[model samples]
Target: MNYIASITSQGQLTIPKPIRDKYSLHNRAKAIIKDTGTIIEIRPLPHRDILSLMGILHDNPVVKANRGKPSQQIIDEESAAFEKAITDNVVKEMGLPPRKK
Candidate 1:
């Protein structure tokens, strides 16, 4: 979908609803704009949670504790929720039905 994004005097571009919805970009979400010579590319920023980076070897007995404690149960759960939300948005944008619980 094509959208007319407005560039502010400060050189900030406000992505339109359709494009944002298509790419699962929400309010205050970060993005990466690239100049590819032939065409410009706009992509959603890499979404990551510091807690999610912990416990890289949660299942490994030796490395589990040394890499720092895993995210608290609450933080882990919230990260999962964030992942699900992004996935759901992508599915919806692709015209696919949501998965059944």
Candidate 2:
């Protein structure tokens, strides 16, 4: 289906109700934008929980090398790494000192 939307002066375009409903999109839903030189694509970002991502690294060499370890251990390590990345980014972007743990 082809739909035309006009961008306002503020550079915002409203997603039509029909398109939104078809994609199960709701207010505050996250959308990913991609620019492919020819056209721009917008896609809904699916929500995921930690439980749904468990065991994804089971086949990884590191995980295989360290066999018998619980998946929670890997999850905790990954979570820490993610948190550190966020903290580092905030510190660098805002010129703020690192927080005391």
Per-prediction CA RMSD (Å): 18.4, 15.6
lDDT at residue 70 of model 1 (Cα atoms): 59
Q: Write the per-residue lDDT of candidate 1 for residues 35-101, one digit (tens) a residue.
A: 9999989889866646668967678864544355555865786688899999999999999999787
How many clashing pairs in candidate 1? Answer: 0
Stretches > 4 Å off in candidate 1: 49-51, 64-101
TM-score of 1: 0.48
Candidate 2 residues 1-101, lDDT tens each?
89999999999878999989988778867788999999999998775645679989978997686587788888888799899999899898999887777
- State which candidate has the highest TM-score: 1
Each model's TM-score, in the order given? 0.48, 0.47
